[model samples]
Target: MNGTSFDGLTVVTVLYRSAGMLAETLPTWVRSAGDLPVRFVFADNWPADGCADVVAAHLPADRYAHLPDDGNPGFAAGCNRAVETVGTSHVLLLNPDVWLPDDALARICAAAAEDPDTPIAVGLAMHGGEYVGIDLNPVSLFIDRPAAVARAPLGPSGGAAVLPTALYRRFGGFCEHLFAWGEDADLAFRLYAAGLRTRGLDLVLPHAGGHSVDGDDRLQGFRAFLLARNRLLVAARTFTWPLLLVAVPVLALAHVALAARRVRQGLLRPFLRGVGRGLVEGPGARRQWTGRRFGFGSLLRYLTVRRA
Candidate 1:
């Protein structure tokens, strides 16, 4: 809405019991934003110990707002709620565990300014001192391996991306039905079908991945269930029935084998439960097909090529 400038940008981040990470990352995030006219909206996903105090301590009262406690509704819902609560020209959906470099936001804004029509500008995610791949491969339903490329020809990494507020609202934001997991891919497919491009910026954001639910078994199982369920739901929502006829079976078989391997590692129950839930709930999940479909050429390229 503001022609790709960072004049009115709201950085939306969902906090899922990430108080410690917030304390570490927020300062860097604020510093990286530089002098851009920016505000922050944080959605707390019903943390056992509330994060309000932590948020307030880190961000000035006028610079940030925290959403009402709404019982762990998941990342997609939290992000959607944050987007609705803020009135800004652009929105940066960020993970709480990510620390931005000083020049990251400037780079993103510059990239957005270069192509105002592009709906999304993505930054590379770095973990353990290496760039992590975020591009989606629809055929395989996997993150594409890194390749030597200038921009993402596929999709943006949901963890650190800047999107125009207008386009985000127009596209209805992320799919809340997903609850968590695969919603990024669903949004990416929708953007791709609409002929909207997601450009990748050279900026890299350091992410300490999976710190929120790192050691909790129950949380891990629940996350696994959502991941499996949402993976199928995304496939169902994005692919044509004919393509699904082939792709679904392959996906199922692959998941089953993986689950079996997990079973051997004493992780059977949760893995099987996830597979079962995915099979049952996937069909009932929301369908986002809007007449536009991924072209065959893109499909072929996706199968044959790896993106960096």
Candidate 2:
């Protein structure tokens, strides 16, 4: 807990084709961000085998920087281009295979500066040592919790988290046509329909999960066609045409019974061409939906919330 306790935090990390896992987790994420005064931005999704000169040869030049290349149509548009070239007011969306520990960015910037409505803090997401199962079910867009479920009301886990930078550019920072998977549950369903409340933090980070296509089989079938067309463009932009016409035919028959159980695990033709390109681009990704009006008691409290 140093560097004036992450004054004006800005940890951001996007780097596609992560050069050998950012040369072994960016120096253990700059020694677990111990001396905090954070500012690490790295958004280099233009990876043609030169991940921004390997993060400017393993980070240094004044607490790391990197931007320029850009053009990588994924990871939420390279985290909205490293939060629009950083000038931090709290950002931390880390990933280069995750590592942080020293105090995990001064306990996630002291829980988003002791929360005065700057909520979104979730961390924990470990990997082989347990703690992963993220589950959110606004009528079942994502759900899989078995490891004796007990984390508490916290859902979306975009690698790691933390927010604010003007509420991530006023909630317009992650839907870049969801070039990657469900785009962090469509940015946590537009930050819970703008009332915003994501705070689950025991502050840990060990991820290493999917180290930039680890053992890639054609980017794992284009990451299952961008997670089956961004889960029907995040359920037609977070439901509500009468819950998206009763949850899009039961989510297209549960994605055709999970593409017939991924065709007996052989992952049937990239899961039926990612469910036929997510039903032909889930209606133009519903114009990148944010019609924010999640009622029905916030969909039964986002399907019985409980991620403490």
Q: Pick the candidate with the highest lDDT.
A: 1
What is the alpha-carbon lDDT for the whole of candidate 2? 0.68
Model 1 lDDT tens row, 1-308: 24554457788998887888888888887887777777899988865555788877767898999886657878988999899987877788988898888877776666666666565545454543434334554333755325345445465656776788877888788888788767877777667666666655656666788877789888777766677677777777776566667777788777866676666756667767766776777666534555455545455555565434
The TM-score obtained by model 2 is: 0.34
lDDT of 1 at 57: 77
Residues 1-308 of candidate 2 have per-residue lDDT tens digits of 11222247887888777877788777777776767678788877756767677667766788777775656767888888788877767787877887766766776777777772454545445454534334555434764333345544333466666776776776777887777767777767666765666656665566767777768788877787677777877777766577778777887777777777667766678867776776787777776664685445566675677655
Instruction: List ranges where model 2 is wrong by over 4 Å.
Output: 1-23, 26-32, 35-93, 97-111, 114-116, 120-160, 163-180, 197-211, 222-226, 242-272, 276-308
Residues forming the 10-long window of minimal summed lDDT in candidate 1: 125-134
Point to the candidate with the largest TM-score. 1
TM-score, cand. 1 vs. native = 0.87
Per-candidate TM-score against the hidden true structure: 0.87, 0.34
